[model samples]
Target: MIFGKKKFLAAVGDFEKAAGARDGEAAERAFAQLYQAAEKAGDAEFREAGPRLAALLPSVPQGPRAAVAVVTGACVERGADPSACAPAIFAGARAGFEAAADFCARWAETGGGELPEPDDELTDEIIGRTGEEPAIGWFTLPQWEMACVAMLGHRSVRRESAGTAELLALAERVTEASGHEFKCLTYALRVLDDEPLVVLHRETGTGYVLRMTGIGDNFQLHTLLAGVLIGGQHVPGDAPSAQEVAVCRDAPGQVPTQGSFNLAGPDGAWIFNEGTPSDIPVVDGARLLVLDPPPYRRGWPAGRFFPGMPGDLVLDRVLDEAEAAEWFAKVQPAKG
Candidate 1:
């Protein structure tokens, strides 16, 4: 039978009670049952329950400062320093934002419609939350929002990084100012657009050794770097876009010798190349490298590489589902 809002809310209340009691496993099971029931019912009344369900769970706190606090708590629980996990969490949030965007794009395409304009409800929410809407292109809203949340989660753990602070401020401002309908994707996009670029300065005894750049393009690379730095697996890849493939194929010279990139971050740096044949460094992480041919070579097999701070960094660390489950298990309320 279909549930009314009252029934749904009551179910959520029951789950919340279970969660509060630290019966995490039981709560999760209850939540799963509700979710499946709602899905099976498939009515508009039940549909609104989705976000409510999320709200009942231990959310990654809303707002900037709160978000950082949550991440810090998680890191502390894991026997890892908050600083160590900050960047990884940030990267993970960014990956999530990107995933949301990809989902939006696919949704639009599959639905065979132009991007839907934000409804008054969403708009009013944004305006109430942020003073103004961050300027975001229509096509990029979903990706932008997904990335913003991931970054926000990261900032919640690591208190340093002026860039994180600035972005958070911007997110708040946007939330307060805009009357645009508040789609999570759109909200995230606005946050990213409002975020200031982060510049990493290396101080050598004399001056600064190398002017290390902040997170670069390729969201995937940032995702990889964050995973390794946090000692976790990288986020799973989304289906490659035709544009991405074309960009890879048509772009310039052959991929230089394997180890030409520098893949390091606040944690440390490492060198990778053909002779050493080490994994790609953070500098060249997520880059399409052409191997076996010099610049402008006729035809050489191009390889997709993800570089990182070298030292036997294994892909399994971040990408493993089991690890994610473990992490979740620790944070989630205890099983009933």
Candidate 2:
């Protein structure tokens, strides 16, 4: 009953081969057998394989499948034109599928634990929202496969509240399965709100305390902001100054500008911003800062470069120039 480590590895290789061959049927059979073996073995290693097994399986095209059923059923049940319901029904199902995929992928990457027992309450909620059973078929696909599905679904649902609702329904399942340990649900909830954003900046003495409003509900916005900040420091300006030109000119062959900011997130490290070459002291070697609606407040010392609203309460904190300069230096690329 004990499938040793070597045996497990062999089985995993077999599964991979099957997957690579695009033999979904064979892969499915291998995974099911592995699941049973792991369960019977009852060891930590075997237990760990459970999550991987679930991830390796194929995903069912739930959205399209659900859409077909809804359109057909609507015509008979409500005596409505299938054509009229096509768009709305398809949109809802698509959103649900996408949200589900995103949630699942996050789970897999962060260590998807054992699949939880079926929760009637959660399943009922999904069915109620989509008018069909939320099957476990989606969990069969690999994380990347699920991610692609979620991405397409996200595009379809963008700006549509019905899509938001469907995503919310999927969030409920994610919450139930993961016991809310993952941030996917949180991200999904934010996406659903689809609120307008207000960027927040505070002087950190070394750099500005960059925060945004609309992001409280948008996961993508948070991702975007984080990427920009971690990637590098940007000093916005209309023209390059002589001093900036000197810095780059002195460095000769260094280029002294145009680069990316690297930062870590809840997931891992990523590039935030890609900077451009420049010749302005503040803007030289600095990433360009573009405010959608330029800052509208002013209260700092006269002649001090104050972009955006000055004296505005929107900024969380403002770093002193010296500190900002120091921080920027640290993140700057090291000379060869």
Highest TM-score scorer: 2
TM-score of 2: 0.26
Kindly list the per-residue Cα lDDT of model 1 for residues 1-336, writing each as its tens digit. Answer: 335645544555566677568676766665555544443343443334433433432342222212322323332332334344345444433333333344344434454343344221234433232222221222233333443343333323323533455444433443343323333323232221112111121111011111112112223222223233222211221223333232222333223211111322223332222212212222222311111111221222222221211111123222234433332232212111
Give Cα-based local distance difference scores for all models.
0.31, 0.34
What residue runs in model 1 are displaced by over 4 Å at the alpha carbon? 5-10, 21-28, 37-294, 297-336
RMSD of each: 22.5, 19.5
TM-score of each: 0.23, 0.26
Candidate 2 structure quality by residue, lDDT tens digits, 241-323: 33322222122221122222222221222323221111101233322222221223211111101111011112344557675
Candidate 1 lDDT score at position 66: 27
Evaluate residue 163 in candidate 2 and report its C-alpha lDDT on the 0 to 100 scale: 49
